[model samples]
Target: MRRSFRVLLCLAATAVGLTTLSAPANAAAHNYVALGDSYSSGVGTGGTYSGGGCKRSTNAYPQLWANTHAPASFNFAACSGATTTDVLNSQLGSLTARTTLVTISIGGNDAGFVDVITTCTLGSDSTCVNRVEQGKTFARNTLPARLDNVYSAIRQRSPSARVVVLGYPRFYKVPGSCNVGLSDTKRSAINSGADVLAQVTAQRAAAAGFTFVDIRGAWTGHEICSGDWWLNSLTWPVEESYHPNKNGQARGYLPALNAVTG
Candidate 1:
């Protein structure tokens, strides 16, 4: 009777130990890495994230997704003021064979979208047009190759990872009523420039066989001139100006990403 009782105790202990080892509640399996510029880094969103000057946001889409889904590893490599070359040199290091998911929004800084916007907001109409034209020329002639390089690097790093490329939203609402911040001429020029940039970005993203989310479409009624704006207009912190606010990341960007990822 004593030997039988001892054997039963040992069996129960082994079963409990195995169950604990095998059934960890929070064990992660998927690896997700986010790479890009201020938009991806969440600079426009209030409150900063880790990673030095990258200015990543806890409220950014990548972090929001990871917060709920809880991937095995989440690397937020996107940085503020990051260009395609910056990404190639700095951000790609976070990727590896284990990376299963990646997201990026690049090329805007390469074309100097912010500078063009500044020119439009403060300078004369023709100045804005000329600046915008310059930006469009760069987008057409140079941005495609730069985008291709970034996409190629992403592919090489994470061959099987699902890469989602998101594009910038148009800044102004055409025929909008407010008429306060920028002139109609400037607004139209900016919008048309955005269209050109999106076209180039979408083309390169498609060529890479990656998913491209058009936040322009997602943010139609919520642009800078709309009554309920997702993007910030000219404001303090200067960098946050023209960038998406917290609501933009949560509602505009996050939902756009989710629709594709799901």
Candidate 2:
């Protein structure tokens, strides 16, 4: 009876070892390429950056996903302040026929988000409102064609890639509890512009047959005005301002990407 019991244990252990050894062989190895602007590059996350001045942080969603998923190859091609043209000219070179996945967030900069924020921060209520309207107009009228160009290029280069197009979050929470920042009017206008950008980007992405992830809903109660801010508020060094913080990348964007990727 003792010998039989020992043989059973050995057999079970051997089976478990074989299962462990085979798991890696069955795991799919994906070729992933990340592209976009500051949001995708992770400017406000405050970790080490690569790709020269691209500011691609270790905490960014792409890196974080790669760390966990162990894709066959990860090309972090995203750059700070990248416009749609920038992606078309510079970023798409990393993507190829073998690229299994691609993720990006763009169009905000093309719509002049940085200038809008700067004007809203320093100028009077009227200036802020007007600037926000102009941004909305640009997003609605001009951004679709630019987005079409980028999406078309992505589809052309990486024909089989599962492309995930992420949109910007609303920068502020209107009627928020915070008292020290700009008036509710400015905050509301900023959100309206963000909505326009999201709408236009979503339409274009869908037309291109890509998955569109609207981060605005995921980032609710965590904008610049919230007590627990996922986005920075009028930060110094200029680039970090209006960008997402670490939690925003890890908790917010990461999960949003994971939901679709998984």
lDDT (0-100) at residue 174 of candidate 1? 79
Any runs in candidate 2 off by more than 4 Å, and if so which? 1-28
Clashes of each: 0, 0
lDDT of all predictions, in order shown?
Answer: 0.89, 0.90
Candidate maximizing TM-score = 2
Per-residue alpha-carbon lDDT of candidate 2 for residues 1-262, written as tens digits (9 for 90 to 100): 9999999999999999999888753114789999999899999987578878898899999889998889899999999999999999999999999998999999988999889988988898899999989988888888899999999999999999999999889988778877546999989988999999999999999999999999999999899778689998876777788889999999899999999988
Q: List the candidates' TM-scores in order.
A: 0.87, 0.88
Model 1 TM-score on a 0 to 1 scale = 0.87
Q: Tell me which residue pairs clash in candidate 1.
A: none
Tens-place lDDT digits, model 1, residues 18-64? 99899853425669999999998898777756778889889888888
Q: Single out the weakest 10-residue window by summed lDDT for candidate 1.
A: 23-32
